[model samples]
Target: LAPQPKAPPSPPAPQALELPPNASPVLSSGPSPPPAPKASQPPPSGPSPPTAPKAAPPPPPPSKSGGPLPPPPALPGSSKTRPPPLMKSGNKTDTDEDSSEAKTKLKPFFWDKVATNANKSMVWDHLKAGSFQLSEDAIETLFGCNADKKSGDAKKDIASKEAAQVVRILDPKKAQNLAISLKALSVSAEEVSCAVKEGNELPSDLIQTLIRWVPSTDEELRLRLYTGELSQLGPAEQFLKAIFDIPYIYERLDALLFMAGLPEETSNVKQSFATLEMACEELKNSRLFLKLLEAVLKTGNRMNVGTFRGGAQAFKLDTLLKLSDVKGTDGKITLLHFVVQEMIHSEGVRSARAAKEQTGSVSSVDNNDLIEEEYKQLGLQAVSSLGDELQNVRNAAILDADQLAMSVASVVHRLGKTKEFLNTSMKSLDEDSGFHRKLVHFVEQSQTDVTFLLEEEKKIRSLVKSTVDYFHGRTGKDEGLRLFVVVRDFLAMLDKVCNEVKEASKVTPKKTKTEFPHTQVFSRSPA
Candidate 1:
């Protein structure tokens, strides 16, 4: 019996990174096709060395043979095809072969096109297995050079081996171009991020950089870092716990927007879903947001103060209010609106707190130039963005507040329209079918929730007051009382509206169902 050649060892297991569902199936580090063995300075008559086998050519297109077919839409991954490999200066014989065989030369653009359309998994697996030099050369010539090869001094590299070289360039611009040629390509920095513990293979320097980046205080970097860090976290409760423990405004904001579904932008569009997952993890961490949400869930409290900006001692008024703005069960949007409103209102409170915190303590304030310079860095006018930024958080917080409030308001307005639709009461269950009665019940419950949300949003700032507006640093009590009276009267009007709605719905007969007035008010419909 003939002896069989031993198969190379299987590739190493994939690292522990949580790859996306559509991540490439190809594994790297397989046996590469070795470079051709050279006999130095061969004469023209000497025999050429045997070349390695080229990859399997693709099947001819059925659509092309039959008739005109629509071009495929651009792939979702990046459009960057890899740049061509540099023609090595040392290989003179390579140039001679190309100059000699201009008649039979394959267009370099053909290889470029193949590189863009080929499956990345196929290329990744082939290069990873072994010494892939020959394949790499083929790939480089194909992707890097052009169809008008005879015009350029392209050293006449052989057409057969261009696929492999295209796979190895790590630069994103080059990589992105190379990726455009393949079936699907993704460009991600290989960051070794970990909150705790370390892994192997990755150099220690890379690991350290990742650690420093993971806990960034800067909202921009933290928001960017949150995506990579959360991917390392895997799908478990513990991973979320670790992220929330760290405090940064962008981290918190990203988490909030993500958990709410309208994820904020940071990286490439392909990774937006990853952004959403991280957002969910962030919402899990916000104690203030979560606690207030629990209260809303319990009493359906719309007018609750939500979380305070600088705690309750900051509020001059004595009570919270309740209101509803939508017909949904969960009050996420309404709650966000209130939270933003409070954040906006609380800026003055926080500024007051900043002043009060420094009241008794004496520090040098003579360095106005130094303070103004610092404010410039924070991008502010007059006052140190620092003083206000203890609220601009570099404008990230304010921007988030604006975005979150807008989204919530859009949703709340949608609920208001649905309320208008079901204005008439339902007929008796006996007259209509049981299904009709169930429908009415669902609408009634939804309307109550909506009413509650509207009420809650309307009343968000009802009890909030600046602890120090103008002071000894003590402001006058009559002024405080005067402010409280204005709020008291407004709350009474809101309560009256709520009571009137409940009464009208109770005694009213069933009306015909109509189209929701605001059309999209049901955006976050019920679930």
Candidate 2:
């Protein structure tokens, strides 16, 4: 701490007076002075006679207590004269001194005492407990004047108030202690430099933690201008000052952290792109999925026969999710259920034909039992597996295009910053300097990797846009990500329908055959 200026001396106490034996009793000290003597009446009508001068009074002796005597009381009589007021020794008046004494007598605030004794952890513990509240005056005295100016609200919670005070005051030791308690690394700047030069990676967590505790501009300036012994400063200040010797320290740390994470980030982005590609392929090429959509279109056209919606050629993918909302006359089976049933019968018939062709068998079955049993088994197997066939679409549905783009952008931005540091801040370094050489190589390699990533990102984004357009017909600006979501939801409804169909097939008697009256509206063609 800097040395504080000394306070001025207090004025001496007033002492008791020792009056002479012949002195009048009224001359004793009192709050008010006595009246002064009036002039003698002028001698009547003639030249005044010269009067002899009276002898001067003798000096009064000092009191036995060996202190100066108080001023004598005024003589009786003419006009009263008041004594001069006591002079103040400094800017502080007597009342100010009394207040200072009172403050000194009061117990110190808990945090203030903790700071003085260097029990920083205890201070934090007490603060975290939040068992005590501080007055505005206590905050000013403990931290500094106007510490609350940042918040402007006096009703802020204790933790925030104390944190704001600590930040504003710039107590290096306290900051360092808090950092250490919070698991900051104890390694010195030279250790870090040596580690980097030796081609060894620093702990990723260590770099992350230290990056947060980097000194602010004002703190850095204060450290640079400090004229005191380095030993006198706290470890935080010393470490910060030492790191100042390493050019582009912050940039280097940031680059190292970025490089450490780049591989995983790139892998994630690649996986997302792959999922998107698979989702698009599944939507465009899955035969059974296309057939299911054809059935939906035929059904919808039949329902809207007399309206303007009749004979519609296509519909948005989002309508697939709404099939469950249209219930049958029985109020149990949904339109999705109807579609699943039709697809099942179609798949079962096709499978039966394929099986018949492969086996070259022709078995005659007059009874409906054999026919119903045979087709039901094949249809349920085909419809139940649709969810598994479009697994990539399910995965892709959870992804956000903008978030992925931002992640790639973040990597590129960090690489750009690293490159800028290498070019600008390390210009003075010789070509042979290990620090400069290593960082330059890192930046160059990173830029190359990021360039590849940017190209991949652009390619994937374009693919996603084209895929959205293929399905949705020119999606809104924000609709690229929504395509997979809509499909994913439709797939969920399809799964529910498949489950219901399988359950229904099990319960229905072999004698009873399931019929689709709605299928009569469309031609019995492949779609």
Candidate 3:
């Protein structure tokens, strides 16, 4: 072949491609590796087609300073796309394309945006400002999340969150207890209505339970608004809704409390009246008690012989207690001890005389030891039994006049509220409505009963005042019970003195007999 187209010299090995020091792997489209040198082969029959010149590598992107750009950051993981290079211009850096790409990638996880506090705050703001409807789950979550966080605008927060109804939701145990208690009551609206109208008493416990379950304002409003099937509601809600069917449910509940408490309250008033009456009778009519007073009066008069207080007609019952405080010439023996000894001797003499009369003969020996022994035994028994005779006075001493009055006033005030309710709340009902008619009739009857109670209370109080004046000669501003308290205290002191005298008689019988003078005779009435 034309001198054999001498074997064409192997094409000079392609020069190794060069890259910038900081350059990353070139993109696939940037350039292709020079075709591998053809396997060593005999020269081609014809000259190899003129070699094409390699395309110059595309110019590197320009930088602000017109220098070679640094390599773009390696993409995260195996991502094939690279973010746009950041461009610095003055103090501001522009990454608009990078930001756009990021936003596009984040769209798939849009809900994750709410995990941030800033985003959550925005959601709360919108929830409060707008009428955004929330599912029960959302409401529960909202309430649970902020339940412990105290906000300055607490009422507004509660209103926005509808927190009033969430109380039961948050405490399922309490809600369950309430439901159980309501079911246990098993009271029907009809029963309540009939009970109120007919003046029949429901169980006080039931009324009290109902009181505890009284709906809050929001809960009441909700119950009033709900018109759905009762079967769909919880037991507590159903009960509340059923009761709401009655007009003026709250006022009716108040009436129920008043009615339930009526018998006990009235009985208490009557019991107080009886107590005052018995106390007055005991104080006025007990003969032994009067005799003790006379002995005390005599002792006081003898002591006050030279003073203006000498020989007074009668002394205050309060002075009887002070007798123990006045010691005799012998400090060991108190004035009360002397009075007790004197009373014992007088009681013994009366017993002996009564025995003499009963047997129709006087004993020949006036100082017989057996008679003296019988006298001492009778005197101790009679004096110690004084507490039993004045039992009602002891009971009266504990009575609080103000409390008794308040009990009556409470009944009146409750009745007044019931009447007010009938005028205002029940006024809208038809006159023929059984509930309205029954409640009105019941209130009228209660008014009459309470009127009688009021009269009785006044009569009993007047009797108490009169009795106080009868004993004290003047009725002071203090409660009548004060007089009973004084008597009760004096009786306590007298009991103690009698015990000491009996112990002394046991220790030194002869000495005690001599100390007790037989001159004084205690009659059944005060001198």
Candidate 4:
């Protein structure tokens, strides 16, 4: 069988062009290569002038021994047309009349392009566009800052540069510190990710610092921070632990989500399901849910549907659904709140209709009385909403000890971080906030009262203790500590409310210095 079939010949391999060490491009003698067509130049025409071969230009002056090519001199008839005249420039060299120089000059070096004495607003605009281009030394000099701002370099280094440029040139460590200390953002504040090249933690203390800076105190920020910290927290569990203790609901929400190993919202259906559910919870919170009511009311300025039941969680659409049902339980509160205003409005209309009828001015305080009633109802419902939220979370997930410790640490961390805790508006100086602050001071000063229930070897009575226990049971120390932060927040809110109650009886002694705007609508009728 082997002898019967002759061996098949192999096909030849394709040859490749390999240049030798001393090889140069081979030129064809048949005809000189058509001179490279000039960009935007007309082609040559007419009979050939001569058949003699033209000599190639000498190999470009051997590249000046190690420098770039000396540009070729203009050949007699190389281009039919003369080049355009160049402008005289103070910073440019004048070339020969026949030189084939490009009209535009070489760009100045990077240094020449800097804004040494640029206006702050001009630089600010550039920075806003992410175009910072200055060196650190240049930046410092321009801003009139030195390394020590009691005269520090930071104050001096405020030069114009692209955001990316400054971030790129600085020592990552120093840059990160400056970024935090300045309260300015090159991009979004959170995008200033400190380079963690060699260590486990960010040397600038970004996590701990942001934990302190996150603008939250009410259910709002506490709630948002809980969610914000979830995605960006990295493998540095200890740093995360430090921030995890922040006393905010949102921060705790972040802790719980991560502790339960809830994957972030992604294209994956499973992860999306979890994120959407929490978002849904937020939408139902009284503040957010109330917007829907406000939206419906605004169409008619304010509306009145008497003797019906309603709630913070109930949508107006739901109320409409219940309109035909047996006695609406809370619709009556909505009615009573809006009824006076609406009745006055109706009276105004009727008075107008009769032309001769007279109507008295509707006092603004009529709306205000209803507003105070709404405030009490709203506060109660808000506090109740939190209680329900905690219940829902506890029912939904169990956290590990590491996660719990992380959460508690974030809270305890922020408590010591700031010299003062003031809401970020001009109204922070109002009477209502003064009493509020005093109350907080009272609670914070009395650690015993704060921890009175911790003395219990028996039932863990306080919200903080219970929250910690819940985390400790499964998650471990870190996350449990974080949960404790949430517990403290809940307790703090409880204290604030209790203090406000005490304040309501006393005249203005218990008022907060901060003044939030008051509503003019009632949330519920008094029992």
Best by lDDT: 3
Candidate 3 lDDT for residue 320:
78
lDDT against the true structure, each candidate:
0.33, 0.69, 0.70, 0.35
lDDT of 1: 0.33
Tell me which of candidates 2 and 3 scores higher on lDDT.
3
The TM-score measured for candidate 1 stands at 0.16
Model 1: residue 204 alpha-carbon error in angstroms: 45
lDDT of 3 at 243: 67
- TM-score of each model, in listed order: 0.16, 0.62, 0.59, 0.17
Error of 1 at 257 (Å): 19
Model 2, global lDDT: 0.69
For candidate 3, write residues 360-473 as lDDT tens digits.
Answer: 886632444445667777777777888899999999998988898999998888889889888877786644555567677778889988998899899888888888888777
| Candidate 1 vs candidate 4, TM-score winner | 4
> Which residue pairs overlap in candidate 3's backbone?
none
Best by TM-score: 2
Ranking of all candidate structures by their TM-score, best first: 2, 3, 4, 1
Write one digit per residue (lDDT tens) for candidate 4, span 496-517: 4444544553574422213423
Give the alpha carbon lDDT tens digit for every residue of 1-527 in model 2.
99755544444322434335778544334233322233243333434443422322433544557554566545535287868766768756558778765642443456633234464445454565567675847655556534444444565566565555432224656566635733456677688777555435778877776687777788777877776676655556666666676666777677678767877888898888888888888878888787888889998988889999998898988889888899989998888887777777777776766676688767732324237668767877887788888888899999988899898899888777877777776675543466566676777777777788788888878888888888667646647678888878888878877777677667976543544342565443343
Across residues 264-320, which tens digit of lDDT does each residue of candidate 1 receive?
A: 221222132233233333333443333333333332333334744322222332222
Instruction: Give stretches of model 3 more than 4 Å off.
Output: 1-201, 226-238, 308-311, 329-331, 362-370, 420-424, 431-441, 502-512, 515-527
